[model samples]
Target: MCSTLPTEVQNAPQIDQDSGDTIGVLDCLRLNVYVPNKASSQNPLPVMVWIYGGGFFEGAAGWYDGSYLVKHDVVVVTINYRVGPYGFMCLDIPEVPAFGGDANSITVFGQSAGAGSIDLHLYSPYERLFHKAIVQSGSAKVEGMFINPDYSAAINIAQQLGFNTTDSNEAISFLSTIDSHLVIAASSSLGYWFRPCKEQVFDNVANFVEQDSQNQYSPARIRNTPLFVGTTSDEEYTYDMNEFAGNPFLDKIKTHYSLSDADLTRISNTIRHFYIGDEEISSDLLRELNDFKQDFHFQHPIDRAIVKYIEQGANVYQYIFAYSSDDSPVYHSAELKYLLSPKFDPLDESNKKDLLMSKCATTMWTNFAKYGNPTPESTEEVPVTLDRATVDKRSYLYVDDENGNLLPLTSLPRKYQNWGQDRDWNRGSGVGPDDGVRIDFDNRTVVGIRIDSENG
Candidate 1:
């Protein structure tokens, strides 16, 4: 069903130059379209737009190959947006171009920072540009995910480049002159430097913590958009943390949140008790620490988003990619290898399970893109039906080595009890652990329930 293009025809123009327009040139914004052989006006297939993630520092459309999804009778469009300080410096540049053609069936899928980008688009005035979204291993609610509009990091990057200017206009002019590679290198070093922000033009999009505080932000804003969000079993294992040995990591966390020594002790002890369970710090404590980081950064935020979306009467599907290979466990971005890997081999014995998982994932994803629901119908390869998440069952897809199945959200490893409601351990507040009424963590209940009851 797949046809290979001739070598000469395979070569497409690369967007390497900066436009130098009001949009701050560095115009690496382009779309790579993969259309099925049978696609035409008579048989226009659904389109899936991919947004790649590199922590807002680096990402490209060329990194992902959408040929696999194209083979499933869908048009796959991978797009490039300005990363680092260029695309998200809160400059008055032209907004990223919206996808053209069949807006009603467009599904935008992204991973990590790319997923976070999708989250921004969901709340932006241009949210109607797409009909569905799939957010993997990232959320708009994660603290520090979005940069502030003041563009402090941009100024810092400019200073490092010898510009020595804080004026926005002067900085932009100087930044426009620097080589793109040099600017990206300097911004990368600044880590958490350039990212999406709440600016005057689009102030509606706020981080989850801000949304919770204002009571004004609501999933109802994007209620018409169906969402599929999920995370890996070990989202943070991919990062090297050997540098965080001893108390340095704790110190870093305290500084990041502006927590006092006493607050840090309470929060660290709470995390330790939950993940390490009274075990003293040792070599084995690394895994527990990694899990804590994963939950705090990725999973907990996702859980909150899912709950909020469901409460808004939106169709949401959740998943936990627990599939592991002999060589690697389900680390962050591992599922991408199954979903978008160009070298995927289904014939090899070792790849049998991977192939199954990949097929299930691609099918479900493409199915969601084609139809609003993932399990609209079942086929021989995919017999089981995945269910949508609801307030009652909280059903979600559990993708494993065998095949995908609908499982209760509670069955997933790790619990997000008291997530945002716990003012002490949450990312937004600095209350001590002893300040709030004790919660029954064993019951796996959210602390919001108690607050809701008390207010009622």
Candidate 2:
């Protein structure tokens, strides 16, 4: 594994698919290897396989540089996957061929849409390749799943473009004949949102759907691998493009959703309830739009998955990025520029808080990559434990300007106790997946976190 990595500064390894095929082998698949210098006594360093997300419609590994992790005693690998109709929609069909072959010890990491891919990949037949994972601003819940709401809208748009969505593969084959970028542009112009869909049960290709009767996503259950997951405090803000006086996609959104003002308001409130939590939101169309963004794009899915993982005894840690500034609104993709590059100076130069926060964030992440735990040193005060341990509820490390702080795992929100359990599951009172756990924040210390197994 180490030998295949790029070692010298001037000798970057070429991109290759796991099948030993070159980058060009699959038009949609791409991979890059980052080998750390093995001048030290130990070689064959740990590896991180990154997946980029563009709502599964657009994004490439080349978009995110891995030199950050590579410079810090780890090897980073990134890949390019098919996007839009050419990629996701095409892959769902039975006749479509699978790309990457078997690979091992891979750790999946991605943000946004890429993170969704990680969640889907975990259920894929090829999932065992990665030992663990890190997902940012993405979740494994169907609510978080990136599905195109407007199937008819897509079909109608295709008709306008002189293609047929009812016969999608035929349309795809015709469209594939054209340049990919051109096809994407043409599809978007007519309000056809390209992303992963509910793969049919028979084919089961890319089985990201909730019901996998064959147990495709339940790969014998690797319960030991650690998971680090979280989202920003103001993630919805990025969707608030109009708050910045930028063009609001209200018309475009109307075209896609076709909702009444009252319906839009209800949908907007639902988004606010999930993403912003109990936090107060400013009264504005932008805030409503932000809510819409979080509802369809981010919150519920991640929330559900985290809840399920915690209930299932998987080692899980969670955080909420609360830091924001004029230059950075704690929005989507802000963490990237920090995680991948230290030299990136925010518009208003990064303050001491920013620098300290960046360092703290990166340190915790690297520590996890090296040892699968984020704590800096071993201690009973904050032991690095997983799913079965209540200690984790009180053992979380909050990365902030104050050089970082560790909070008791028990201090997390009480809502977590009941995070992912379905209403039906919660019908009876017990401490398991079947039991619906509810967080009583006012009376309980873990407001939105830490499962209250007793009442739940």
Candidate 3:
């Protein structure tokens, strides 16, 4: 167990705030490396780089302890990258230096916004720095994930900071003089408005727009990188629904997406029919809303990404984390506690199953890091050797305790079967092997849904 001193970068800009002076960018970027007690540089074990997530606004490397993963004979690295406006403001600056390591044996993994960062890196010119990736509950294709050519939010943030100039260059110059803490404070208040933007070149760093135009998982970009992507069964169980309730929420959606008044009313009615049919906003309705949010934000985008990778002939593994305690029942980021921490108590009878599940998950993760496949060897209880995801198979590993082992799901879930029905973007298009109904994207509600006769 070895840790490095946090070394500040030279020429780092400072921001002034009421609290104190803070660096515009986190100058004290550090990488904490952990290796097994028996391992050494000569042996050169496989490396797993963990990126933490806090909605792209707040997160730190120190939050995650990789000691448990290191004990599995792999090198675990937790790194610090800039977050919010300072990190992703689309400014012309020196590129964030890459970590020095064996690029061939590196696997980059992260959860939520961290996962989104990995997606950006995967499409970056520096993608060759890592060999594989694991994206947990996030994707670049998700709506609003990448802010393309839209400096309005950033300009708004600067104006809020009392830098009212409209000229991009002048505003940026003034912003550089402000305190970093104040900038972050404004970003927090603005929410997801300040995030990574597309089409911007920073010191020749690959911009997101160019990469996104091409197939994200194509061999041309990713070079057939193996990927493990998944989401929790109840990813949005903890979501605060106040943001999306009532007419104001509808108005915001309409304005943001440029949805017409007619389209908004139609979509609202459809949403009500699917998620709140004949029910008040009760506990059951909340559950439905949670599922809808999860599916729309995390699950659907991730599933689409996985399918794209498979289509591009890249090795991919998909999973749905269903293991949860009786109290929490599979909330977002719940898997992190189990996978990262070794303090899982075996004495607690209620959590015994979770403890076992954690061990299995860790083993699979490390195995994938070492080898391209997750389950290279079969376990005794389940005797399951998980298959590589393919366009034909579309196989997904369902991680739960019911069978005490990984179970393969070949068919699309019922909810996902008609996924394209309500989606205005992918309307009139069929996904997977099934010839499902194709609906058109129009202003009218209840767009014609045509069921494939063969499947029906």
Candidate 4:
């Protein structure tokens, strides 16, 4: 009954488990609060806020349920924020007030695009908003989400609605004056993406993004609270092998980092060589293709954020979710089946082991919310103690490789460069957690972005 931003209400590829109605609204900024029965005014429970991930274009609060998590004796808050253009316009607008909660014990967590947003908070001055953050398979830079206002989307989208102008201010003005629905329709028609653009920060700028995490990575500016990072063994564990032939995401990356033409070609060759070596890109190289997609889309960006987190002196707890129902490969966002449970889980049929994993993930997450550490003490469900990943040794907890047994935290080989077989997720290896999370194809093709301000 409230208002959401001017985005299509449905999530991209759809959250199959979310049986809620999908309708776009404008004024419904809501906080779906789930408080444990034990919580009272006198007794404030540790708060964990859920941020849905839909590539900054899709997602809704109505699709998620926090009741399963509240059973763990924590206050769960599912938030709704302005997305697409409304969310990231960053044009000197009044700041929207977030839900008021126990600030000291707040832990923000999300997956994919949601995880990317959580990672962004670490760079802002408002790092104090949450005492801790759990980033799942994403960071601010994931999927080339952040950029300067280099694209002509304002003019192009306006032109779609019968307004043609090259002036940025004028185009924006025309866009602002038109019916919001008209703008949305036009944007949808031309595949315009209104993403978070890196801004030039100055004195008295209200809610402006100053620098990118890559160019302006300042460890001193971030709040080094206890951080938990989760990654599925493969981003998109299973896919049509031929879909990724010669489709390197470097085109998007070329624009994201503003690479030159010469540099682009050189980097592309190097990357393509690494992924497929001298072999031509085709259906035959499914494993290499998956690796390339996984690295470019998820792990590399997350790895960048991890390096930044470590540099900031944050107590970082990294996890690789490898549990599969039949001991097969687990796909991207696979842990969500365990983390959200019952509802919000696409896999309707859950085995006893799945339920156990649900307990393990929920307990671990809620434990981190209550106390910075995930495994302060071993429980029946989670018998293994998790160790923090450090600068010298990048050790992280491997979650439930065995269907029933919680695997102890183990040290991964110093770098991913050391691994020869990156695609085999189920392979038992001393280096890495078999495989890290994979990337999605929809993220690249569905969401269209300008490669450069001039040509693309």
Candidate 5:
């Protein structure tokens, strides 16, 4: 069975000169390619590049093993770019002349910081190499701008470790002189959450926040490629370390915002207004903290980008991961198991059902990569009224409850609107300390209910 599995590796060529001195030019230019052993002869296998995300601080090409996608008849490419301040920091260096070359029609995909990089590549002045972009669990709103203090701290730390960042001519040159680990360590101390600073306008791609509606750098003109955006059920669960409950970072945030004891009670409110399209923070007290984190970081930001893409008349699709397990902590990257293996869970029939849902997800994703649409009915997942140019009927894939069940994306809002008619429905009845907000169920109302009495 192991010998029957098929995969091959290749290197993609870079058509540009290395101006920065941080990493070797050969290392900076090389990209790893995972090819299918049994590619369709009539139509060369569609490509799906994976970009691993570690908050822009940690991750490498080795982190993602693309054998699964390759076995499914897709070419997977993972490339290494300069990371942290070295990869992203702008030093106002003179522009190098563009290497003359034709572009390839490819689809770029990534999660977290990788997702932001996809967005950046789409808008880069250098001609893009991809025809579609799949941004998973990352949005430009938070990633579009870097905090000035964080940037300064990163540079200062790099210098302390003896890496240069000041002189444009010597910066990339000196970077190549130092060990990779040292530069990474110095950048890590300043924090892994740096974004491109909006105040210092560099180029259109780096200046994501500065690009306005009227500006040519908007997402509408950023890329003429198909788009796929998604997020995990609980994106931040992995980051919650109980040991750091009283960490200095929390104290610093509280002081910066002047947060009082009462403010913690309404922390959701601040997060909502700041990130969730000004949606009202749920008034329910139970589980407010979890819901707030979900809204600001995952749900709200992803939703905003999806809507924006739809309004622009670009091809798009929206999805929510509703499958989870009672035994598993509802945390980030939990869905990876479902995608990587058929037997991700086996203890119960419910786990078996989630396996089916995982199949539906992979099917939709591969279908979109091959056809430029998730399904035949929709090229983009946009709102009804927001779509004005031509009626591009949008549909969503809802892997609901158990099994590979799917429903129209619009059914969520319809279910919400009609919940009052159901006699068993109660909006605020089960409200409790951990129940979070009591609300009518739509598609977004995902819960991993415990069925076993022993677990209960």
Candidate 6:
């Protein structure tokens, strides 16, 4: 057994909501392990590791309490990885995936940046690290801004703090001496973020990424790895919708696909016309904006990755979180609250559906970890059998209380890739009402009984 790291507050930075003084302890790499009561030396339980999402610049392990999943008899591990400059700071230090991925039995799962981490791992030299993966709301096929190759942000941050250093050594040295929290705080103040960078191949140093992962995504490269990939119906609804108004997919389209200037203009104009017509914008801009963001960031990339996964003969379980409220629609990271602990557990009779949905989430996740399939065989808890994506069609488990109409992938981005407007929901995207399409029945698509549970 490995000895544990020191107990310290999360290595957080100054963000919009969270202040650095509160939980921003720096360079703390630790793991919180919650083992089941039944887990013994003789009877070892399966393990589930949690990687929190904070756009790669923020987040800590303490945010997610794994005690809820431990009730189901699996060992849960939540780890603290350095964030901001510290997360990607060049040092002779290290860490995967013994639990991140071990035999074919292990399943690596995460949400947003955490999910994006899985994508990085898949594209890196470590693609074979996990046999199966559960990517909730992120993939490597992101915009250029997220993945930078230069150390300009680090230098910019150093200059912003106090030491107006131009040399890389001087910048890193100055930034290193300050409080980890301050470096992060300074980064925020400067509006500069040091994200994952593609490294130049050095002889001895361990490299996380050598080539741009966004450009490296391909079925031939990823090989056959079972995937549990999904996205919420309205992936942008939970955020300030205004953020997406002017920010369109055209920029991502330019970088994602190397197109000529003439071709790029034609595609951009077509996208603008299809999604948001006229420069004044439409009244349904927020609604349409949500759809547009979903398609660009989450929905489109996920489909592209899924197409590759299926092409490589990987068993892929796809889904869309359709549950939402009047206040917040089913958006990015919507399905996470139900999967992990530390969520608002409403005991009132009016919220029975929420409780049942939570149960289904935990069971399906644990099921996926134990068995390669999310629903190897359905039980009272998980009533429906989730089919995997095949070469012919894309099968998905729509996690919603109402509506089962499929959002045909072909309906999106006609000029973007000419992937064909496949409006047919025959095999991969087919789901009759009998296969647990709606929630009016006894939570048919999921599995769980309100077994009392909570976590610190």
Best by TM-score: 3
Each prediction's whole-model lDDT (CA): 0.62, 0.50, 0.63, 0.63, 0.46, 0.59
lDDT score for candidate 4 against the true structure: 0.63
Q: Model 4 TM-score? A: 0.78
User: Candidate 3 at residue 309, lDDT?
Assistant: 68
Q: Flag clash pairs in model 6.
A: 381-447, 381-448, 382-447, 393-428, 394-428, 395-428
The candidate, 2 or 4, that scores higher on lDDT is 4
- Model 2: per-residue lDDT, tens digit, 287-372? 55564455334454465565555555567767656554444456776677656641233322246655555555555566667677
The estimated TM-scores of all candidates read 0.78, 0.65, 0.78, 0.78, 0.62, 0.77
lDDT tens digits, residue span 177-279, model 3: 8777677677666653446665655675655445552135445765477888888888877546584566432453354355456655655544445555556
Cα error, candidate 3, residue 268 (Å): 4.2
Task: Give the per-residue lDDT of model 1 (tens digit) for 1-456.
Answer: 643231211112112224422222365566677767776665566788898877775556666777767767777877777765666666542212232235457889999998877777766544266789999988776656764466466577788888897676777778778886677667655654566666544455433223321122456676766888888887777345564467643554464455456545655555456566666766667776776677667776677666667767778877888777674657778778767773322223367766776677788789889887777777755566667876555677776655345343433342543344343344322211343332222222223122222111
Candidate 4: count of backbone clashes, pairs at least 3 residues apart or interchain: 8
Model 4 clashing residue pairs (backbone): 2-28, 3-27, 3-28, 4-25, 233-436, 234-438, 235-437, 235-438
Q: List the residue pairs that clash in candidate 5.
A: 21-172, 21-173, 21-176, 146-195, 146-196, 146-197, 286-436, 316-380
2 versus 4: better TM-score goes to: 4
User: Ten-residue segment with the worst summed lDDT in candidate 4?
Assistant: 447-456
Over the stretch 1-456, how does candidate 4's per-residue lDDT look in tens digits?
A: 112222223322221234432235456476667666566556667888888777776676656766666778887777777666546544422211232236568889988888878776767665356788888887776656675564567777777888878876788888777765565556656765666767645567544356664544656755467899867777765468545534464654464444456545554554555556677666677776777667656665666567567767888988878888777676777887776642345434347666667777889999999889888898896787877876556777777555467666555522342221122331111112212211212232211111111211
lDDT of 5 by residue, 90-197 (tens): 444420001111124357787777786675566555555567787777765331323332434444655767665765455556656666656655555554544544
Runs of candidate 3 with Cα error greater than 4 angstroms are 1-25, 91-102, 152-164, 189-192, 201-217, 238-244, 247-256, 275-281, 342-351, 380-383, 421-456
**Model 2 clash tally, residue pairs:** 21
